[model samples]
Target: YNVTHVPYNGLAPALTGIRDGSVQACMLPYTALVKNLNGKDLRVLAVQSKARLPWLPDVPTTGQQGYPEMDGNDSFVNIAAPKGTPEAVIAKLEGALQKTMQDAGVRKKLEELEVQTMFMGSRETQKWLEDDVRKFSTIIRDAGLSTK
Candidate 1:
């Protein structure tokens, strides 16, 4: 299939194009389309995840939809600080973040926004970031993408 790429400035315009029939479809983050999906303005054919999102439990994952290769693109939210930040400050921040994640109201709000909260300590987050960089580096090379 010959595909033409049409870039939009942001999620709003891309979603507007889809709604106004200027574009047929788009691959966007579930959070970006959560409101539209709930409002019945759009339909999701499949999610590009290994498992269905909790917010869109009925939607099939790419793997379940016969596109297992499309999985492994999950995004995450992490907190970072300057390289020279003190370890005590880092621990305090991580503790506060984890506590916030445990709060019922915070979790509910995050769920409403279609965000999954996964709190990790400093060491775990460092490992996760390193792994993600290595994984995406391989993916970029395989896809012939270049920073230049």
Candidate 2:
């Protein structure tokens, strides 16, 4: 499949372009599209995630359209400190994160994206990242792919 990639400076411009019909189409994370979706001026052709998003139950996933292996469901925002940051600093950051996640508004917005705000401490986050690296590494090797 061939596609054209249009790079926008930020979400505002990209969204404006979509709203004004400057671009024929664009793809973005579903959560990013949620607040504006109900307006009806824009339409969601397909979701990139494996399952249909709760906020957009009517839309089909890319996998459902035919590519069953296409499963890019989730996005994450992580907080990381410098390599030698002290434990107290990490604890403070984690505490703040936990508090933010507890907010009803934030939690509602996150659920719309189908994102579960994970407040894994640095250690657990590191372990998860490491495991992901190994898992993707194996997949890339099997597919004969490389960043290079």
Candidate 3:
């Protein structure tokens, strides 16, 4: 099948196209586009997340769109410091992070933004990264996809 690839440098242009009906559809990160979905005469064909986001519970997931067990919302973020960062600095950073996570205002703001925070300390983050790399490598190999 032939397809058109109209690449926009960023989300702003793509969103403009969507809003102006210049494009029929495109796959976008849920949170980035959720604001547009509200109060617009738009229908979400499907969400990529395993489960619908709390803010958009009415939206069906890609799995529910008949692609069983599909995961379009697979993404992660990580925190890292320079190789020789002092332990004192690391401890300070961790303390700040923990305090932010515990703050009701911060938590409420994040939730309102529809972002699910997965806060992990350095060691746990390292382990999670290793596990994810292994898992993703296996998936890529099994799917016959490669960077090269």
Q: Of the pair 1 and 2, which is ahead by lDDT?
A: 1
lDDT of 1 by residue, 1-148 (tens): 4545578888899999999999888888777777788459999988887788876789888899777867756667777899999999998998899999999999998887778777889899899779878877886687667744
Tell me the lDDT of candidate 2: 0.75
Residue pairs with backbone atoms closer than 3 Å in model 3 (clashes): none
Number of the top lDDT candidate: 1
Better of 1 and 3 by TM-score: 1
Error of 3 at 72 (Å): 6.2
After superposing candidate 2 on the true structure, give the runs of residues whose Cα lies further than 4 Å from its correct spot.
68-70, 99-116, 120-148
Estimate, for each residue in 27-113, the C-alpha lDDT of model 3 and write its tens digit. Answer: 777666756775774567877767776777887888987865455454555668998999899989988988988899999998888
lDDT of 1 at 43: 92
Candidate 2, residues 92-133, lDDT tens digits: the string is 989998899889999998786667565677778898688767
- TM-score for each predicted model, relative to the true structure: 0.79, 0.62, 0.66
Per model, state how many residue pairs clash.
0, 0, 0
- What lDDT does the true structure give each of the candidates? 0.82, 0.75, 0.74
